[model samples]
Target: MICVTLGRGRHRTLLEEWGQAAEAGAELVELRIDCLRSEINLKRLLTDRRTPIVFTVRRGADGGLWRGNEEKRLLLLREAIVTGVEYVDLELDIAKSIPRFGKTKRIVSYHNFRETPADLDTIAEQAREANADVVKIATMAKSVADASRILEAAARSSEKVPTVGIAMGPLGVFTRVLGRKFGAPFTFAGFNPERIFAPGMLQFDELRRDYGYERINAQTEVYAVLGDPIAHSLSPAVHNAAFQKLGINAVYVPLLIPNGKLRDSLDLLSWLDIKGMSVTIPHKEAILPMLRQADGAVDRLKACNTVVIKDKVWTGHNTDYHAAMGVLEEAYGGATSDEVSVLMDKQVLILGAGGVARTIAYGLSRRGAGVAITNRDDERAARVAAEVGCRHISWAARASTPCDILINGTPVGMHPNVDESPVPPAAFRAGMVVFDTIYHPENTMFLKLARERECRTISGVDMFVRQAALQFTLFTGKNAPDDLMRQVVARKLGVTRD
Candidate 1:
């Protein structure tokens, strides 16, 4: 049986939307009092209660919209419990602050602001220590690998009670649809945008129809991407297509977690049923603290793109390194001898200073290429440069140097606003390399301008394919069909082949 959170926070949509959802055979209907603007008469609302009801007055402290301080919020939650609601959700922090309840069992939870926590046992212990009836953890996944870790940890947790594991992001969406497969009792869904508490949540219809329950299961391997602005990701198109082609039961989706909450997201995964996830920008460095063990490459990179929960412990790895290497090798076929050296000689200029840049920088360094990174985020660029041991360039010097391979690592070329390219054409050198990670529109202005100038170029599509293949390997524990994966990516990117 599956329960759907019909409306979020204090939304009045519950009376209509939740009732309709219940009519659709939804096993449970959640009334999120936290979203309501006025007091809810739970006693009056449950007069003809048909299904078991779960009531929550979510606090802003834990991924909710409620604004009341801890004391006031607790007063409301206790009122709901005393009013005879079947289950009441309590933020683990708030619940821990108060003494244990003698009668009501609380659904205690945590939310991540940065990235998913690296350990489930520790997360679950926190929830357990609070004496929560159902421990729920939700983290912001920076990549698909993060989603996998959330699900895998949920499946691995040793708990005396049921737990809800979730990755909150566009990349975490896959985990929402598939959480049940990993022994999770519930997966949150966004029925109305006005009421959505988390980011990149699928509408209830999309969840039941496009990403139906019959597909994902306990044996189904999972993967996803976690990023701040993930709506532009073609990962779903790539991974879902591969799953269909390979006759695999798995699927991919996105999750969005705002800053400072990735750890809470990982706590959700600790309720142990997920597989693994992909980590992304602004989170690779921030995610480091949560890992139990990061050996060899993972420790060396001090960054993680894939998190695996084996035996309830989350061990991190950096498959993005492989993905980055593949992207460089394929896009610049003779990367071994020609292009990289040329790029090194010319001091390749990179735009955007997020996780993608981090991996790409490392990849470029391995090729003996000197690099310069510049972005609007001065601090982020500096940090990324520090990680790659490259020179930090300023946005003011956009055209200061003739870049051999000027790469745009930002979201400037993505769709719905596809015309926007970060660097002006006047900045390009006739024989330079212009690489744009934007693949959906293979000929972004950045790439198109370079084409007109006869400059060498690479599309982010190559990187997407390679990273996805690495993800496929991580999820299925099988060697990926590299050629097949490339073709799939090419088709999705609308690249016409010779």
Candidate 2:
């Protein structure tokens, strides 16, 4: 439905313009009092409107021109509510402060004027708390990338709350078109240039006819990657691209679930008809206990990389285990017989024990590799080792003896930390193989030390591609276009293939 915003100081011409817009098929009027002088009256507009009205007195923090005092803002908002405008645009921050507003449906909003927040989960948390009729997030967008991040966040719980994503720049133009795909109820468009209310806003006709966005449907399938600081994920890009290629009508997105809400957040997928999800980062392990059931590698490894809902039942598995192992084995000279033997022996030294450890240990154990786990956090190292029935050693004890193979499962030697190897040169032995699971730097000090010792050395880039290839397979259910997937992952990771 069309809602023509009344410009500031346009009070003298409001009634006549409203009639013209209505005649042109605008369905309702939106009074943007934030753009108007304080003297312009909501009571007067309510008195004249035969059509319903939505009133908003947005603050400057929210990309609005409202420079008025907080007391004055609240006063105006209260007046609009008391007068009972059909809808009132209220910042979710202020709306949740009071027990209630008068009869109007509140279009509660969130805005990020700075660079997009690393976590969209926090934004969703704010919306969950606001309890508004709808939730809106406007992020200052510098590229289609930034816009996509916001659109992805809105996609996570569209059925729960009709969300709005306002991308405020030229790169943000795609937002209006993609908004519908993500269940965004409406997009902000400008009628004129100087008076353009938002950045990258287009005219309503342009949005309707040119962009071709439509109302969200109840049957649309949902999917997303849940994590904290989740704004930069490319699963939406990769998965959505795959969907378009395969002609799947499904949509995949990203959601920030904060640290504590992994269960409540992923539950949105089940409640909203989400068929599948791409889990990442901290959420990967945290989401383990939330699944209705987990089988296959997930049952043994106790880590799940993919969760699929069938007949409303959530089934989980760790595709990453085989993926990463396959990649590492393929890259490390097609995997030595000893490497194959280590998984069953429980004698391999794993230098890092984070999420990747889940895949590494699980994969190696399945292959009969004996694993030993260690980390900076001794307790965490112990936990991982105990779970896999591998022995644990302190970081200081790394030089004690040569294990069958030393795997760098941590990011100590990654790009920014390229100089920091988890294991020192003294930790290397001439006969042992070393695997540094840091893909970005290509080779870490650990791998270099192993190389200098004339020992077998392998890079982490292989493991990354292998894990991603598995995800690609699970996502498409077809053999991952191996060459294409490899190129895609290599190019994206700035790594070259074997």
Candidate 3:
């Protein structure tokens, strides 16, 4: 169940927002009376309301705006309870002072702004001792491990009392969605973006449609795309739609794994019994050494984008190789042999020396194409070129060198940097084909310049969708809905399909 929070400043606005929340399919609404500047008719607010309401007048220390005296705050809560509300939220500090109302469930909540303490069980036990009908444990998550600890605490505490566990922050978003699976009776979501009251809060529509909040169960398999700067990824929208289309009991979330923490994060995945994961950005190459076994594509590219855990062993695979190659083949459409021969003789220039650049270089080299690599860091560029048996072109000489195909393997013109281009506009020629690996901004500056020069262009959307489809197959052992994946990605990127 998704509980929508209403914290508008005016009573009239609050009532209006409540109706909106109800229309949005919210079964419950939380009214933060602390946000009101003046007193409201609590009886009128509850009258003729079909949805259940949870009344809360949070204080300043508890991350609320209530500035009244403790006596007045307690009076307000008591008044709300007498009005026949379904639930009353009280801080754990005042739980002992306030007696439970008849049939009005009491939720003793604890909010920690610092960190998830080492003794969560002890705190939860204290709430249970207070005779709370529901226990809410909310804490600031410093890392993925911190979120995991909170979930573990919830699973343990649920056996005693109904527990609502939440880890607040961007890193804690996974726990917010997966908390229900761990035994949370209901989870909270903002009715809209302007009404969000907590960090890492998602909208109800996103929770319901994109994350499969209502459909997720303890037995549902979990998969995710791991990256540091993951806000720009469309994997969740694309993969979740495919899961719904195929009726797969699975969910794909974005896991923000910071640098040097991959090894530690894998332990959490094992603990949660996550079925599989799709690696991205810096972790693509970093995850190779940690896997028990790897496919030939991963061995050849020296990178892994898909990891499937079977019988507690992790096997890595690289879908980017074939997915990328297939896109290039479609662009150079003709007979299969004719396309290969055309690619083999063409001079292909690739920019950047990261995991993606390495994958493209390896795949192109294996197809007998003459691949030249350049990067801002000469050492890394030389290393990738040497590994791929290709020549490393100096960055200063990229614009002057002529090539039939140019690929922006770097994230120069990705979202939020849409104005920046890796290659200069003057470098583009009339006949060259330009491809950028950044898919967030469908038509990047690099692609725009290529289009102006009458050069053929391919957006990164094709490669992203194709690779994710391949990862889906590896995760579920079912054929993915390719067209649905493409449609979802295009919609997410605000691109018009032909």
Candidate 4:
């Protein structure tokens, strides 16, 4: 069950949002009465309750806006309990002062915005001692270990008292989705996606639709996409949609693993029993040496974008190489046979010397395609060129050097940077193939300008969909629904069709 937290300044707005939450299939709604600007009218606000309510009056120290004194706040809380609200949240320190009244349940909670302390188990035990029907702990997670501690504590507490342990941030998002699996009664989410009352509070719709939270259980397998800036990733949306479509007992989540921390996080990831993962950006090349086994493509490119863990063996594969080659071959109507060499001897210039660019360069070179590499940082570009045995071009000379294909491996034309193109307008020529590896916006400015110049263009969406589909097959030993995958991504990207 997802508890939708509704905190509004006005009673009317709160009531309106409560109704909206109900329409959106909310089972429990938390009314943070502390957010009201005017005098509290408990009777008027609590009247006509559509769903069971968890009445909360949070103080400033606990990440709430209750500006009154402690006495007044306690009075409000006692009043709520006396009025027989379904539940009343009480801080661990103040829970004993107010005796239980009527049928209202007690939720003894602890909030620490600074960090998840070492004595989480002891703290939870203390909350349990407060006569709590449910023990709730919310803390900031500074590392993977911190998040793991929260989950472990929750699991232990659930054996005796129902617990909701949340590490409030991107790194700890797994706990929120996996709470039920660890015996948590439910997790908290906001009614509105834009209005966030707590740090890392998920939206109600996202929990129900994107994650399919209700289906997650102890037997459900876990998969995640790992990167530093993982919030923008569409992997969870696409993969979760596929899981629901195929009736697979699995949930895919986003994890924020900072650079140089992958090796340290292995134990925590293993503890969570993560069966598979989709690697991205900085981690792609760094994860190569850590893999127990890797495909030839991954070894050759020194990068791995897909991983499958079984029997403690970690194997890696490079879906980007195969996906890029597949799309390029399709664009040129190359012979079906791999031995025919469709891109044989074609001059290809790749932008950026990152993992994606390096992978494409090596793959093209193996297919008998002549490749040249260039970047704003000449040293990195020269390094990649030497590694692939290809020529290196200066960034300023990119447009002058003639090539049959131009690939934008850089992040220049990605979403939010949509107006910026890796190559100048003069670089695009008629009949040349232009490919940009940014998928959020299907028709990037790079692809749009290439079309205007009469150049054959390929949107990053093709490669993204193809690559994700390959990952899907590897994670689940079944063929992916390719059309459904494309539709899910298109819908998430807000793409409209004719």
Q: Residue-wise lDDT of candidate 2 within 1-498, one digit each (tens)?
A: 435566655665666666665675566667677776647666676777756777887777776788768997888777778877788787867877644556788788877776667677578667767877778787787543566577677777576787877665654554554567667655565443356776556566544433233332445456666666665444554555455455556566555555776775444334346677767677777767768898677877766778877777777878667766665455445656654532345357777778787568767766777667778889999988777766778877877756877887877876666677776677887777677777666667778878998888777655655565566566557554445544544554552222
Please provide TM-scores, in order, for all candidate models, with all chains considered together.
0.56, 0.56, 0.94, 0.96
By TM-score, the better pick of 2 and 3 is 3
Model 4 lDDT per residue over 1-498, tens place: 899999999999989999999998999999999999999999988878989999999999998899989999999999988888999999999998889889999999999989999999999999999999999999999998898889889989999999999999888887899888888989999877668987788888788888999998889989999898888788898899999999999999988888999978866767788899999968998888779999999888888999999887999999999999989888899654647678988999999998788888988998889999999999999998999889889999998889999999998977777788887789999999999888867888889889999999888889999999999999999888889989988887883222
Give the per-residue Cα lDDT of candidate 1 at 476. 69
Q: Model 3: per-residue lDDT, tens digit, 340-370?
A: 4446777899999987888888888888888
| Span of ten consecutive residues with least summed lDDT in model 4 | 489-498
State the local distance difference test value for candidate 3. 0.86
Clashes of 1: 64
Give Cα-based local distance difference scores for all models: 0.69, 0.66, 0.86, 0.90
Determine the C-alpha RMSD for candidate 1 after optimal superposition of all C-alphas.
Answer: 10.0
| Ranked by lDDT, top first | 4, 3, 1, 2
What's the lDDT for residue 335 in model 4? 51
lDDT of 2 at 233: 49
TM-score of candidate 2 against the unseen true structure: 0.56
Q: By the TM-score metric, which is better: model 1 or model 2?
A: 2
Top candidate when judged by TM-score against the true structure:
4
RMSD (Cα, Å) for all candidates, in order, is 10.0, 12.3, 2.6, 1.9
> Which model, 2 or 4, shows the larger lDDT?
4
The residue-level lDDT of candidate 3 at 477 comes to 89
